[model samples]
Target: MDFSLQQIWEHTGLFARFIIFTLGFMSMSSLIVIAERMVVFRKTRSDSRNFASKMGAILAKGDLSTAANTNLGKDVGHLGRVINSGLTAYRISPNDKDVAVESVARALERQAQREVQSMKRGLGVLATVGSTAPFVGLLGTTMGIVNAFQEMAKSGAGGLATISAGIAEALITTAFGLLVAIPAVMAYNFLQGWVDARSVDISESSNEFLDVVARNLTGGETRSQQQAG
Candidate 1:
């Protein structure tokens, strides 16, 4: 009995076919998530670089008043969003006081968390597929072998040859499962590492912005005190 893919699929029972279909869907879903995450990360990294290069000096100088009124071109990435939130908070603040820095810090933190969470979207699907695909494949194989045994018993067949087709069909599901799972796990790990690295970058940048805000507020207060005296 030939046990090629076509032969196995053609002779596979409904349960086995369904398992194969499920693995296929999982593979496709992982691929889509991997592609989407890659694109998002690529765009975000580029935008963040551009934003940092162009806006770092202006933002560090605490020129929030001018920056708030200016159009910060589109797609400044996660860092841009966090910076803009801080700027907005600063603009609304009444004065260069402890209150202003505290408020801006809160805003930056909130936006940073939001950006990290947003970037993590669709990663759950990859994790789920990576972790569970093998079990799903094993389920199909188990059922396939059981069905093969049942058929053998009914036919009174007592040789490997009798169940070879059924065994092959069952094993292919496991192969398919592993084939689907390995890449998904690898992709998940790689993307997760990228996300972690970006998260750290965002956190460090937010802290730097906070330092700038504190210094700007303190400097302004000192200038006012001297002028008033």
Candidate 2:
């Protein structure tokens, strides 16, 4: 058996060819998704950090309007959007502390859900490829073993040379499948971790923003009561 690339391709059976083609497609798709996600996460992380710094300064100065308008005409990330949502809600019901707090809380929750969905996009495909690629490879290996036995039976000889070619060709698909699967699995885990960490940041920021809104609202209500008294 020559066992070269040309020889393997030429000797590959129809089933083996189909399996290899499928694995190749999966690998390519996963790579594309990984690249796209990397870019998206990077941009969001950068934007969020910038938004956080500006937002901290604005909040420290008690400028709710500026915080609300910070991302109005500009591109912002998940944290910015969430903060804007809460501020917008507060603006809409400025006088009623209870209404403002409730509105901001609801807005934060809704924005969090949307951000999570955006972060989780394409993760399903990676998970599917990681979990199933190995089984697909195993199927190819089994098909190759059957092919080896068939060749032996037809030749009426159990010699190594008689069945080795079929066995080798069959094993090629399995090897290729594993090659596709390992990276997909590792990438899936890495991206999942990134998403989780970002989710935590969004949560913490939302909580802090809510506390600020609550305190301001409570103080305003107390001052109004004191003036009335």
Candidate 3:
């Protein structure tokens, strides 16, 4: 069959429309996931930046009361949650130096893990869409080609133009699928990296905070004993 590329582009077929619709849905889903991830990453990144500053101020000032005050808030990031947990532990057992630090560190670890997981939410869907979209598009194209050949079989001497519509639809769908998949895959991977980095930051910050708390309490003990003597 004789088929010109121009003729294929000009015509729409069943395969083309099906592929177009499928690709459209996939693209829309990917966009939604991207938007969600962007919001999460932005918030997490901001939190990580502020956390160190706030923590440094708390350690330098040696004011547990003010530190507690500073750490208290609903909008604070993962680091905030960890710090707060530690602070809470200290408040609960101010005398038991080991227990206070351990309790808070353990609790914060759990909370940090949870927050990291939350940030990663919906990424799996994006990955799935990206990985599978191309094959789906190819399937549509294959079906279109099959239909075109069927038509050629019946027509005996069918020209390319005769099946041009089907073939075009197939190819267009495949292109659309790839277009949707690539960005989704890229976004998913990028977001994953951001999540990993933030998780590390939270862990490190929490550990440093515990160290500061231990040092502060030890210094306080030494000074108190000397004063009493």
User: Candidate 3: misplaced stretches above 4 Å?
Assistant: 1-11, 220-229
lDDT of each: 0.89, 0.87, 0.77
lDDT of 2 by residue, 164-196 (tens): 888898888888889999999999999999999
Model 1, position 164, has a per-residue lDDT of 89
lDDT string, candidate 3, 1-229, tens digits: 3246566555657656667777889889889989977987788667756775766776777777578656445667767776787777777765766777677678778787888888888989898999999998898888878877888888887787777666766787688788989999899889889888888887887787777778877887898899999
* Window of ten residues with lowest summed lDDT in model 2: 67-76
Q: Provide TM-scores for the models.
A: 0.96, 0.95, 0.84
By descending lDDT, how would the candidates be arranged?
1, 2, 3
Name the top TM-score candidate: 1
**Index of the highest-lDDT prediction:** 1
Model 1 lDDT per residue over 1-229, tens place = 6767888889999999999999999999999999999999999999999888877878756776676666668899988988888888988987848899899989999998999999999999999999999999999999999999999999997899888888998999999999999999999999889889999998899898888888878888899999999
When sorted by TM-score, best at the front, the candidate numbers are 1, 2, 3
What global local distance difference test value does model 1 have? 0.89
